[model samples]
Each structure stands twice: as structure tokens, then as C-alpha cells.
Target: MPDGDVNAHRRIPRPAWDVINQLALRRCTDETHSVRFRRGSEITRWTLAELDQRAVNLARRLHATGVRVADRVGVLSTNRIEWVLLDLAVLKLGGVTVAVEPGRFEPERVIEKYGLRRLFAEGETSRDAVQDIDSVLSLTEPPGTDVPELPAFPGYDEADICQIKQTSGSTGTPRGIETTAVSVNSSISEVQELFRHGDGDNILVLLPLWFLQQRWWFYSALVFGHDVALSGYEDAVEMAQAVSPTVVMGVPRLYDDLRARIRASGAPVDLPERRETIQALLGGRIRYLWTGSAPATRATLEFFNDAEVPLYEGYGLNETCIVAKNHPGAFRLGSVGQVLPNKTIRFDRDGVLVIASHHPVNTRYTWCNPGDNQKVWLPTGEIKTYDLGHVDDDGFLWIHGRVDDVISPSAGPNVLLPPIETLLRGLPGVHECAVYGRAVRFLTAIVSPNPDLDPAVLSDRIVALNETLRPEQRVHAVIVAAEQFSVRNGLLNTQFKLKRRQIEERFARELELVYDKHNGDAAPPVPPVLVFG
Candidate 1:
């Protein structure tokens, strides 16, 4: 344990060796449902013993493939039991696991950066450059090991790097985050103490394994003796209903999808009953939900909570993994809640949140080599987070906008767009809205309103919103989206956050029209422009 740090309440023993060694010491009571996940069309369940043996067997296979200790291994796959199995196998062999986002497939960069020699690419087209993973799992695979006897678990030290996590690229290029066994294990222990998750808790994990929260849930589950049910976006609701998971972890987009479904189902008409039904649909035992990555709509938070399933928002980034969260003891509606135990937070000169973690964290980006310690951190170990926020007197953290996103309009006053867009989401017929500016004089908006809204009515609403803003900050004009921004379209990411640069480029012509109308001699047609700048 580090000096000046205390974990008086962390009951579950922090890893003496690594999590794998501790789990190896754990004795299953015949009631532990360690893992439950679906293969292509079949479901598989693994008990604690079975899960351990599989990792042990897989560890031998990994070693046979020439995976030396401290070697880097890449995994590019969707969420599945294999991802977990391979991760454990690599750790048991004292290797590093690097998660590469599937579909985007940037293996060359990851390989070059991390010096990776092997890659486990499941369900992917064989690239000529990397080793293909052979241990593709199926539902029919028997409980017993099919491989040779288990080798000595090339045990790892607490300081050995075990995982490399990539950011969501919310602001810029996704930076790879490195972590050691001590940090990862300590993190699981910290969260376990906060939530008190135990054997009775069945966690439904919907986000892909590449996501930070998804990996955190899995790590916490195996060590904490909880069961994890894995499912994709398409089957999450159905699986949740069947699994009856006690907790669910996901991004804000998931709740948005559910809220949309409930609206279509007319469930909110009866708040109490609707809450029960909805929670049941999401696996009735859901005590409270975990959400982060992006800002969740206030309407979504209030809707689920009003119905009984409290949606708790938290804050963290790729750099500082799980820094603060809103738990049952301390929760504020729009805030990301209080900083977690073993952490200290303060604001920088520009109101950017600076964080100091008592737990071990990677100090620099291995690939890019961010900067020297003095420049990257404060004297107290608080690292500067580009996220702009303020802590209230009550100790709750409230995010305002991205420091880089504080738009300075050459034509007028500064504008903060997140709040404006957040307000627009509450409007009657607006399904989604994205406000845009920068490299331009005034603000412009690209709105995706509910299809049922009357064009005339929506136009009026946009005009009404404009009246509330100043000349420089007001949305100069609105362009109603022909379709919802989607990940496939390159306008949105997997988290449902607008890819600002992509959206601006995609709507460059429309944006030009908005500014042209704002400053040009003639009005660039009404109604089509929606609202004038």
C-alpha cells in the first residue's frame, strides 16, 4: 500500500500477487455463477472453478505460441467470453493485453507502438500482417480442458503492466492508457468497497469489451464473486430480462435508446408500474444503473429515476480511470457526483478539473510519450483533465463544457454550446440536437427532431430558443437533419456523441448558408433555414 493512503473500509483483500493469483486461491462454494454469456445463438455459463481451469489451460497455449513474459498481445473483438479468457490467460503468463477497437482495426499502429508479436482477432477478416487467434470459443465446448497439462503460471508482480486502454476520442485522437496489476486490482477493490457488490449481484455488461467501464465491471466481478451476463445492444433487453442481473453498466446512449423505447411503448403514463415493468425488462434486480463516457440527458436521468430505476452518472476519462462516481450515499442529479475515496480534486486556472489519485496510475502514454512529469502533473500529483468543471461547496462535481469547446466567436461574445444543446433536448418535439461553432463567426445548429413534429412548429420552437440567446452566442440558423447522426455515417461515435469535426465537414454547405444569411445582404430564405442567426 502507498504511504498517506488508507482503505479502512476495503474489506475484500487487495491483490497480494495479481487478481489471477487471488482468484486461483479462491474456493468456489458450488454456487458461484462466475460467467454467463451467449455465443452466436447459444448461452454458456462457467462456474468459478471452470473459469480458472480454462484460463490455466489457455495460458499453456499462449506460452506455446511464443508469448514471452512482458510481451504485448493485442485483442480485437466484440464483447465475448473469449475476450475475458484471453485477458486472464495473458496475465497468467505475465504479458500485457492491448485492446484494439474492432471494425476500425488499427492493429498496425497498436502493434508498432506496443511492440506486439501476437494478436487474437476473433470474427475478423484475416489480415496478412498478424497472428490469427485460434481459441475461438463456441457454446458446445465442454467443461474439461482439451489441451495439455497446465504449465507453471508465469506469475506477475504488482508493478507489471497488464492492460492498455484506449480513450473514446471524445475531444481528440484516442490516447492509449497503460495500467499495472497493482492499479487494476486496487481499482476493483476500491469500487467493491464503494458499491459492496457481492455474490448475489448479477451484472449485465452491454458495452463492448474495448470500453473502460466494461473491462472494469469484468475485473470487479471475477474478484468480488459476482456473475456477469454479456450481451450486445440488439439482445441486451431480452437477455437482461432473462438474466435478472442485479446491476447494469453501460454508456448514456443505452439509456437514451431505452427512453425512446419507453416513449414508444407509452409506459411512462403509469409512473410506478412503468418503473417496475421497465426494471423487470432490464432484469428486475437492477438496484441502480452506472453511466458515464458522455453527458446523459437530464430527461433520461429523471425519467428512469422517477420510474424507480435510478440512473447514476459518474465522471472519469481514459487517463484517470474511475476517478469519481455517484453512489447511493451521495448522488446529485446533473452532477457526476463526488470524487471517489483515495482521490483529491481541484480546479485549474481555467476551471479545468485537476485530479490526484492515491491509487497507482500510468504517468505517461507509452506510444506518444505525453510529456515530462512536471508539465503533465501538479506538485500534489493532480493531473490536469481537459474537461471543464467546478466542484460545489457540497463537494459534488459539475461539468460545464470541454475547455477546448468554449467557443470564442470572432463576431461576438464567447459561447458555451453544451448547455444550449442540453436545453434543446427537453423541448417537446426535439429528439436530439447538436450545436456547432468554431472556425466560424457565430454559432449554428444541426438538429434531429422527432419525425412527428410539424415542420412549422419546430421552426417556431427554434426561433423561440434563439430569442433566449445573445447575438454572438445564439444559434444563427438551424438545419433540420434529414436523418439521425449515426456511427456508420461517421457523424456520431459508438457513444452517440457527435463527432464534431465530422459533422461540421459533412454539413459544411449548410453551415455556410447559415453564416451567409447572418451577414449577407439578402435573407437566405426562411423556414429552410429554420431560425435566423
Candidate 2:
């Protein structure tokens, strides 16, 4: 992806932070109510003035510790108001911040590779992960730390790398994506304008602060003088009753779980009244719902649509920023909405989606695996998104599949994963599964059945589930995996996500026999090297 010509993207720009910083100051002095953090039975809030003063105190502490401009820092913690304040404090000092996903983050590797000036984690995090660096400190001070007076933060500019997003790689480790201050500010502005976000909106925060989908909303709330309601991962329907948020956003899993829970209750999922009941469970004031990170389940989407819930889908990566999104008056299911305003999209000769925008985007990578750089940012200021997709005649983008996810064989239709994997996950006896159809005779899958069920019985259940599929979509054979993909097994990313390519490699030999049996002239013997029941 090359910048080609930036004519379509050029806009008169100012740093988004400085402008929003001023807004925070104004709101604080006006005593405007700003944030609400939820605990078991308590909803604590802070006025802009109180929030500003606390942030200033934290900034002074950071400065006291010799934090300075242009230094890279790492944050490994969960979502909280303090996370945003620390992030803003970093930006104020012209330092760069990196998010380390706590569940799967390798703290020591990040500290060495990024040469972090400091690392911040929740006090509750394992001491082993925090290590013994003087730079490793709790995100906030305990009862005994002293604070001295300090001057106001001078703030940063386009040249300063304000944040680094660690992209999980196929190999299980992650590479850092550097985002400049200008890029972040412009993204905040664009998202605010696109969503028509204003000061009056009460946003319900669901995703963790480390994720771009959630992190940007925190920035938006600060910029627009809105309120944020932090909810934990639980029954969102129950959580909504506590917060009464006007908008809710999360990954596809959050909604999928809600749909499953509703169906289990024997409630109707298709009728208009049922949709309203689902919405009511979420505090009854949701203007629209939004999901990203992965494709939404068709069942979840259809369920919400019948309930008249507007669920928008978006597509982007850390390197490319927000590429395209579905929104009001312009949305299509199975499509990732329209190309966002001011962004230009085109497909390469290889059918890979390429995005170009003039807003000061990320320029380079830090600690990327070999050959991964080709898929990140290029010299042309364009992002080479390896995701394969094309723009429709109506200007919407539909993802075809990843360049590496294809399972093309000698004489059958190719199989694309996720769609296959997600379907398998819905079957009763199936606990976990993955599909591989590349260069084989037909589609085959590796499965981990529920632990409580008999192995042969579960395999038979999968065979029955396969009959519900079309010829190309059907799984002709199933390999029973010895265990579920997990962090301990080195198959799941730190975020507990499947590193599909890695999983395939780990089971390469086992799959060869599975595919051979499905397409072989003779009934193939069960894999001897594996624990196939």
C-alpha cells in the first residue's frame, strides 16, 4: 500500500489532544459531571475539575520519576478512569505509550524491545509479570507516596509517537504499531463527527481501555465533554439496568453471548417485541449498537435486527486506523459499511484491501517478525491491510478472506475459515474446533469435543451437524484434537485469540491424514501420532 496521491485525504489539521485538553480544562472549571465508574453496588463519579486535578497530580508523579518527551512507556492494566488519565499524562509530556494486553502479555520482552521508560500495571497483576524494574510501578500511587507541585504539561505534536499498539502475530508474540499524536487526534475527531457524538451522550464502555475500539471512546468522551459508564464483562442486560447508557459498543463475542443467553431463556428472538425486550435489558435507551474486531454471528445480527436494534460493523487494524464502518442511513449486512469520510480505499492486484488517508498515521514498526512489515505501513503512507476484500458498486467493502486463510485443493471449492469455525462452535457436543481446507481435496476440521461427553458420541454429533451445510461448506472429516487451543499450549494469542496459522502448523501432520481420509480412495486409518478418538 502506497500513499499514491494524498489529494483525497488532505485536511487542515491541528493536534487533537491540545484542543481536547482545553475542553477538559473548561469542563472541569465549569464543574460539569464527567465520568461514572461502576463497582459492585456503587457508581462513583468525578466532576471535570476533580478529574483534572487528579490527572495533574499523576502527571507530577510521572515527571518526578524523570519521565520525559519521546520516551516509550508500556501500560498493562484493565480499564479504569486512571488509565485514560495516565495516557493523557503521557501525551502531555510528549512521551509514547504502549498497551500490553494483561492476559497474554509478555512484560519482560516488551520492556527490552521497546526500551520502555516505565511500565504501569494494576497492583493486582502478578508480581512475576511485573518483574523487579524500578520503572515498574502501580498505575496509581498507594497511600504513602508524596506528591510535589509541578507545572502544567506542555503537550505533544505530530512528530511525537503518542501510542504504540502491539499487534498479536501469527507466531504468538506481538509487534508494536506506532501511532503519532496527530494520527490519534485526527482519529478522535473523525470518529466523533462520523458518529455525531456530542457532550450530551452517555456512552457505556464495555471493551477494555487497551483495545482501540474502547480506547478511542475514552478519547471521544474527553474531547466532546461526554459521560462514560464503565461496565464489567457480565450480563450486559443486567449491567445496563444500572447505567442506562444511550449507546453500547463491544466486540462480536459480547453480543453473541447475550443472544445465547436470551435464547436459553426461551424468549422469542425474531419478533419486534423480542428485540425491544433485549434492548430494554440494556437500560432501554440504546440509540444503536456497534461491534468490531471480528465478524458478527449471523444469528446475533438477525436477532437484533428483528428487535429493531441498529448494530453497526467496522473494520480496521492498528496500523491502518479506522478504515470503514456501517452507520445510520448507510448500512448493509455482510458488508463493513461505507468507507469512512476522508479515507480512500482500493484493492491491489492480489485483491488485498489497501487504505490511504492523509491524517498523520503510523509510519513504522517496532520488533515485527520477518515478512510481517510488508503487511503493515509502507513508505507511501498507505497501509497494506492483508485482509482480502473489495468495494461494492455502492461503495461498501465486503471482506473476501485473508490471503493465508484459503484452503484450495485439486478439484473443489475453496474453504474460508471463521465462517466454518463459528458454525462448528454452535453445535452441542463441539467444545472447540478449527477448519483447514488449503490444497486438500475437501474441507476438513480439527475438533475438541466437550470434556463431559463421550468422544465417539461427540464426533458423531459433528457428523450430524455437517449434514446441515452445503456441499462446499460441509466438513467431510473431523480430527479430534488432544486438547483445546490455549495459552499454555502456545496456540492462543495473549488475548486468548486463535493464532490460526500457528495452530495449523502445530497440527500439520495430523491434518494431512484427516484430509486424506475424507478424500482418499481407501478408508484412511485414524491418525496414530495424535489423540484422535
Candidate 3:
């Protein structure tokens, strides 16, 4: 589709490579001393020209190692200047960059599945893993290795595939999603329109760069000639105070942590002066705050809304590259926003959300198998999003949960798990809760109590929490497990999201006993020998 017709449901225009090139050229000539970081006793500044040169050098070095166009080069490192440089370098070489989120996956698992040939590490610890790579490039000069230093290289066309980011794989195995320079440019345009970003705007990037959404914020700011402030390994609160960014992007957990910190500091929650301080600190110059990667809780939304900061919650997957997003002007508290101009959305007979957009939906770097690909239909040549949601009366889109996760029993209507889980997590003393309907009559819960408080206190808290829940939505009883749900235990995927199927299967026997007892079909067997911390 031509760029102009992207919204008209036509083919997306050819990729635009000049966007980054122009930024580099202008940075070389004009802005020589833009401050990138500002913390007490630690300040860093870089000119566009310097960044361009470094990116070119990194690209040249990568190509010298026999990397070619469309090759999947994995980068496993923390957020830093090198991470950005490697991304730009990959774009310059027309290679696909697969960024691994920190602390999410085992090194061996990442290598085995992704077939990573080359890797860039931030330190020795990261470099020690992944033995299959032909070469290891250290951004921080880890000791005792023959890895080459980054070099300068030339640029490539904007139409080239720049990055191949893996899906969060919160529910299943991770799949690489190919994003072309053209699609990225389209994404930038979409964000610019959605957020109304313009020149002189400062976008604070608090989330990790490996997250595809954060990449959108970075590109959008750069394409619009807005200043980009990056926080490296700093706490979210400290970053906010130091950067004083006009725009901030975060997940629900990040916002919740910030709110908790603010409240714990004895700051008056309802004071007008404190509210103004927060607005200026986080949104003063900021026009909007964006949250996603998971659904935002009502409490998080209310906290920000009461502070007068517009929280634009969006919805997308790696496969589609942000098909839907809420705009500041068209904000809705519980909705993920309307479909993007270039996309079409509708519900399947089962209430699964589907999307159709102009960009090519699949690429060689990441191939959705026949089974999975079949779920994303091109009935009218539009890619169907497999999520479950509905367009409300006001034309806003509200996502309930995944279609596959809707639990229906012979006794009643299907129960959506996400909303219920969100409500449960919001209750006092509840750390994390996973809801799954087992057998026919019972909804079971596997809960983790907050370690900071006593178990006796948590039990009382859960009782109070139950009062706020609908009877059917409430868990019959809670199991205070010693271990937290995590990817390492196969209970969660790398994105820190619950893997319901895995959790259920792992504890199937215990759940069966619970179900049989509750239904009065049989006497309850002895409780499983589960340990509690």
C-alpha cells in the first residue's frame, strides 16, 4: 500500500530508509551537545553526528563477520547506548535485529530457539553464555576475550528489514516478528498522529529497548525531531525526577511501583501541590503517558487520572506491530483505544479479535506455523488479530481477554479470566493471582502472598479481598505457595506473564482433588504436600 493509502486499506508504501539517515546527517551538522542523561554527578551528552558514525562502524564490523541482509542477529544486553547503536547498525546493514529482554530467559534456551549467530553483550556475565555464536561483541569491553571492537559502515535502504523482534511469548513459545523499515516508518507516523508528538518534545524511555513498544517510542521521537531521554540501569523514579521528561512510557508494574514509592514517602496523595509536583515531574511538559505489554489495572488508571495525567493504554502484539492504540484526545479508561487508521478490527463468532493491515504479515525470519497462521486469517486480505475484544457504543475498543482463555462450563456462561485476575490482584495484600476454571463447577486460584507481610495478615487480607469479588469470580480457597510463579518454573513465559495451561497441568492432581471435594462427588483427598515459605 502506498503511504498515503495506508489508512484507506491499500498496500503500505515502500520502506523509507532516509528517516534515520537524515537524522544522522543532521545530527552530524547541527546538534553537537544534546544531553542524553542527567543524574547527580553523572551526565552524558552525545551529538547526532557521533551516534551516526558509531552506528555505521558497528554495521561495518557486523558485515565483516559474514552477517548478511535478513540474517537474524541476536542482541542480549541491558538498555544502553550500545543497544541502540547495534539496532541502528543492523538497520544500516539490512539485517534483522532480535533483542532479548533482560532476566527473562536462560541463555541456552534463547540460542537454541532463535539460532543466533552473533551476539552483543553488555558485560562478561552476558558474554559467558551462548557458545554457538560465531563471535561475541562486548559493548562494555568484558575481560579476556577475542571479540572485535565495533566499526563504522555505510547505510542501506529504508525498505530493508531492520529488526526482527520476538513476541513476548507470554502465553507460548516466542516467535520472531519481522519489521521492515517501511513498517517502522508507518508505526512512527501512526504514533505521531496518535500522541500528537512534534518537534522539541522529550520522550522518556523507561522500559527496556527489547520491548517492541519502547522501540516505537524511540523511533517516533526521532522521526519527529523530538529529544529522546534514556535512563540506563536507573530506578524508574530516579529516571523520572532526573529527566523531567514531558512524555513517559511504562507498563502497569512500573507505574504501580512509582505510585507506591510516592505514597510511602509520606507525600500527601490528595494535596494539590503534590499533584502538581507529580504532573510536572512526570507529565509537566508531558502531554501523554503510554502503558501496555499487559492490561493496566483500574487502580493504576485511577491514580494517574486523578493526578490529571492522561493514560493512553494501547493493545498490540509483535506479529502486528501495534495495530491498535488510544490517542490522548480519544482517551478511554478501560479501553485499549480504537484500531489504528491502517487496520480493521472485528470479533470472530467466538468473540476473538481479528485485525487486517497493509504491511506484509509474515517474513522468513519468523514463520508462523500452519496451525498458528491459520488462526490469523486474511479473509479479505487483512491480517486478523487473534485477540478477543469488542468495539463499544462510543467506537472505543475494550479488550476482555484472549479468546482461547474464555472458560465455559455446562452450568453457565463463559468467564473471562483476565478481568477477574486484574480485580483480584488489585485487592490488598494480594501479591499475584492466577485464575483458572477447573472441571465444571469451580474456579480455582493459585495465589502468591506478599512476602513483606505475615501469612496470618495475608489470610485476613484475602478474606477482605473476597468481599470485593463476585461469588463466581472468587477463588474457593487460596494456596499460599512457597515459590512465586516464574518462567524458570515453566509457570510463566519470559515476559513475566502467567502461563495458565502450564500451571494447571503442573498441579493437575491437586486441582482434581479440590474440584471433586467442592462438587460433593467424592470426599476430599488429603491436601497435596505443597510447601509454603
Candidate 4:
């Protein structure tokens, strides 16, 4: 390890290599430490000691089932205490964990692809889906009644691949990203150093446990002697109010939806009153809000800022965990804060972002196409992020868009799509949308408008937006999709980012008709838009 990394580890109370031991240490010293989980109207709390005991007992049960070092054990469930217990048990036994988001992807395919020795799935529906598979186990069941005791903690190397996290699959299929104990611990330490989380800090995790970041926060709570409340996205608002947590991490879409609801409530015009209203809506205890996973609108950012709400945006990838972040101590609008310590970033000649760290999460993809792996994970231990971005003089990072997602029309100049898409998503009645066209005569979009948004009103909004863009960048027409883009529909990934390829494929005929009608036009012109499912 680099000297910098060695020094960084000093902030952590115990070495992360033996994370279970570290949790036990916290349990010994901090009897008040606890992790809470919300299920319906009831909340479950587990002390550090309880958490450690359950995990060890569960590990014993797993060992009886023949689970061993390096076995790929899978967990399919929503955000729950069982998910955390199973993950800890797997790691304690020196096994790899493949946490699949329940119902997002077919459980059978994940099990087959990863060659899982055992799959612990939750819910009767999920269990029935793979009842014929002998390897499948019940995730919701309590730890077995009788199990052999662990004579001693399992032995393993910190560098061994311990976890496989799935990418958001926005551009293509979700690939498994390998992570090691050292990397996971390094990330947790870096975050703790940045925030200095301690007593009185209660974190509410709203994202699914399948997300690696969420799990990292859970581990941080165990190591740092703080409190954590886990809940699914549906109850995020209610849980926040119920728990009065000091920290909440969410994506831009969730914030946008909250912004809509807050606006619908007609916040007070008085500045102080508005601030109080917004804070109360979020449980009145949020010290700061963390958002990422997608670009946030300036309007949304400004709304929070004007109300004195600390909504800090950050940037990172599944490959390079948490490259940059904005915090209360340091923040900048339109930038994902400064690049975090212990990581170095540079832009390629094409302006694509590249990052390197002494303690990287992983150097390569464990489950992805060979070509895809070659393009992103370099032989030099650097992760090549295909995102176009640059650091300002102050060192804050600003993202443009993906190089592959850039739009290039045959007749007009090339243009980026995110800036335009961000503007459209900010408009009322627009749920989600995607701009599509490559080497084509004109640009077009497929929008999923809210049910109440009038067709004429949406057309007029698009026409108004086009007037602000260059001819090549203007969206001449759009197909208003009747169904919204969601995880169930396969138009979006679990992280709520649009699956561009899937969206374009779903609306191929509409796009062809759009070009056929407007191909002859010499310049950008607003035309009658069609609404379809």
C-alpha cells in the first residue's frame, strides 16, 4: 500500500481487512451503536453486538451447507436486515457475494451466469421463480436453529475478490464489477475522513441494498460507531420524517420528484418560511443531502440553495467508487465538488475522464464483454471513464456527457444530448425522455409525459425549447410514450438512468417515421408531434 493509503487508514478505528473484527471492536466500546431497518410501520433495531452475533451464527449455518472460501453466494432481496446479515456472513466465511436487485433482473439468469453455489432469495414470488433449482435458499428465513460454532474467524486475503456489484446498465447490459476487502475498506475510510461522521449522525439509506454505495454506508456505520436506518425508496420520505436522520443519500430523479411535490404544495414565498417547510418535509433533521447517479438540473440545485438546504451533488462510477463529492465544508454549484483525496484524475485527448487510485476498487470487470473490459480497464491499473469532463481551475469536476452518447447529424454539427435532455426533464409533465439519432438527417426524442400533461401543451413546450437550440441540435419532433420508462419496463436500470439503446430500440418505427416525414426539410422546423405508447 502507498504511504498515503497507510496514513488514510489511520482515521479508521480498526483495519478494514478484518471488518467483522472491527465491528466487534465497535460493539465492545460503543454499546449504544445501532442499525435500524424500516418494514411498513414497524422499525427494527440491531446493536453492533447483535449484528455481529447474527452474522457469525448465519456464517455457521452457511458453512454447514458446504459454502467455502471464494464461493459465489447470491442474495436477491430488497433493502432489509436479512440482506445485510447474509452479506456479512458470506464475507466472514471468505466467500464472494453477488447481490442481485430483486425483480430487476431474472434471478435464474443471474444464478446461471455467476455459477452461484447458493442463491438466497426473498419473497414467495422470488422463491417460486427458482423453486426447481436445488441451490436456491430462503433469504427471508431466520438463521437455522442449530449450527456449528465458528472455532475462529475464517482466514482470507484482503486482496481477494469478495463482492461483485452490478453496473447501472444505462448504455447496455449490467456487468459485474469485482471489489476486494481492501478496496471496500479504503472507500469507507476515504468517506469517513471527508465527513468525520460520529455521534449524533444518523444516516438513512433509501436506495436498495443491492447498490454497492448503500452497502458501503452500512459498513461505515458499523466501523464508525454511528446510527443507520435502512428503507426502500417508496418510504424514503416517510422514513426520513420518522427517523429524523441527519444524512440521506439519493439520486437526482428522487430529488426531482420531491421537488415536484414540494412545489405542488405551494411553498411559502417568504424565504425563511420556505426553508422551514422544505426541511420539515425531509424530517427537519437533515444536515446535508447527497445526490448523484444522474445529472441534476440547475433549477433543482438553485431551489435547494435558495432555501438553505444543503443538497450536495457528487460524481463516481461502479468501477471507481466516489471520485468526487460536494460536502458542507466544501461545495460548488455545477461541479461534483473537488476530486477526493487518494485518487488522481485526468482527461484523455478526447476529453474522456480517466481515474487512478492507490487503492482502487477494482482494476477490471469480472463479468463483461472482453471488448468492453479492454476499453475501460487499462493494463496500467487505471479505469478509463468514457464520460467527457474537465476540472476547473479550482479543481471541481464538471461532467458533459458520454462520448458515445453525443449526437452527430450527417448535415449539421455534432452536439451533446445531456444538456438538452436536462432542460426537457425540467419541464412540467415530462416524466423522462431520450434523444436519439446517429448519422441521421434530423434529431428527435421519445418522451414519457405525465398522464395529465396535455399533448398540445407538451408540443408547445418542445417548440419553445427548440427555439433556444441550434438547427442541428433542435429536436424537430418527438413521440410521447404512453408508458413511462421504469425498471419493470426494462427501459431504465435500477439506478433510474435511461437505457438509451433500449429506448431507441423500443421506438425505432416512430423514429423512422419521424425522419421520413422531415428528411426533405432544409432546416430545423417545429412539426406536429405524435403521441404513442
| TM-score of every prediction relative to native | 0.87, 0.82, 0.79, 0.88
- On lDDT, the candidate that comes out on top is 4
RMSD to the true structure for each prediction, in A, is 4.5, 4.9, 6.0, 4.5
Better of 1 and 4 by TM-score: 4
TM-score: the better of candidates 1 and 2 = 1
Clashing pairs in 2: 3-380, 28-48, 28-49, 104-494, 275-307, 407-437, 407-438, 408-439
Clashes of each: 1, 8, 19, 0
Q: Model 1 lDDT vs. the true structure?
A: 0.71
For model 1, what is the error of residue 160's alpha carbon versus the real structure, in angstroms, after optimal superposition?
A: 1.9
State the lDDT of candidate 1 residue by residue for 214-306, as single tens digits: 766766666667787888766888889878888888778788878877777776588988787778678778888889888988988988888
Candidate 1 ranges beyond 4 A from true positions: 1-31, 106-109, 123-129, 138-155, 168-172, 369-381, 439-442, 467-472, 521-528, 531-533
Per-residue lDDT value at 438 in model 4: 78
Model 2 alpha-carbon drift over 4 Å, by segment: 1-27, 30-32, 38-43, 103-109, 123-149, 152-154, 234-238, 410-413, 422-433, 447-473, 479-497, 502-519, 522-533
Per-residue C-alpha lDDT of model 4 across residues 1-533, encoded as one tens digit per residue: 11112233433233334553354222333568788886556887777667766676677777886888788888877777777877877777778888776765666787788888877776434353243211222422355556565445445555778888887444466688878766676677767777877788889898888887888776777777788888888888988888888888898878877877877778587878877887898889878888998888888888787788888999988888888998877799989989877677777667778888767778777788658888888777788788998888888999988887787778768889998888888777888889876777767778987656677777788788888878777777778887888877888776788888888889888888877877777765555455475
TM-score of candidate 1 against the unseen true structure: 0.87
Judging by lDDT, tell me the better candidate of 1 and 3.
1
